[model samples]
Target: MPGDALVHRINRIQGQLEALKRIVTSGEADCVKTIELAKAASNAIKKFAQAYVETHLDQCIEEKVAVKELHGEMRKVVHSSFSL
Candidate 1:
């Protein structure tokens, strides 16, 4: 069940996307609502990516495959990615 939390996050994002789709197809889509849902989905994706990468990095470090130097590099990558 270690991945259960990640799966839950994915399901939530999927639900948001489905709602967005339903609204658009219903021909009564509220522009603000659609935008809000879209942004929510986008933020969820970013959060998921950050969590996944952090877990991977932790595993790598635990296994002695990741060096201290990689921390700085990974930090830079994560920061740059979220800056968008």
Candidate 2:
């Protein structure tokens, strides 16, 4: 619910997968099409994750800066961040 654009993008990606499934089930899709669909899905997910992580840092880490006792919080976030 963060924004209509984010939700719309997600829905469009979902629709693409559903359409791909129909193509495969109908025996119209081949290996190349499947791979391309997968790549598109991966790119969509990567972009979404990047936006989500940025928003979380802006909201949580910025707020944590006001608390002087949690000096290691940022370090922990960096260490535990996605290796991708």
Candidate 3:
């Protein structure tokens, strides 16, 4: 189970997505603004994923494997996943 902090992040991401949807559906949507909103939502998603990974490493990884190398690899994978 995720903590309160992760819930907060999820709420923020939902809000961003909602805002993006509203702009896209509105009649006077600006292209730049829409792109910005989309980027913000994308960034929020990436941050959510990053935070979840950290939480998983802290709470779940200890039971399954060693943290030394696995932690580094996890971070690398997450970072690369979000990288352009």
lDDT of 3 at 9: 93
Writing each residue's lDDT as its tens digit, candidate 2 over 1-84 gives: 566667776887798788778878898678888889878887887677676676565677667766664567766656666555
Give the Å error, residue 10, model 1: 0.4
lDDT of 3 by residue, 1-84 (tens): 578889999999999888888887787789998898899888888889888887886666566487677778778887899688
Q: After superposition, how far is residue 59 of candidate 2 from its true place, in Å?
A: 1.4
CA-lDDT, candidates in order? 0.82, 0.73, 0.83
Segments of candidate 1 deviating more than 4 angstroms: 60-84
Displacement of the residue 38 alpha carbon in candidate 1, Å: 0.6
lDDT of 2 at 47: 79
Q: Supply the global lDDT for candidate 1.
A: 0.82
**Local error of candidate 2 at 66, Å?**
11
- In candidate 3, stretches whose alpha carbon ends up further than 4 angstroms from where it belongs are 63-84
Model 3 residue 64 lDDT score: 44
lDDT of 3 at 43: 88
Tens-place lDDT per residue, model 1, 1-84, is 647878888999899999999998999989998999999999999888777776576675666555766777768777998695
In candidate 1, where is summed lDDT lowest over 10 consecutive residues?
Answer: 60-69
The alpha-carbon deviation from the true structure for residue 76 of candidate 1, after best TM-score superposition, in angstroms, is 12
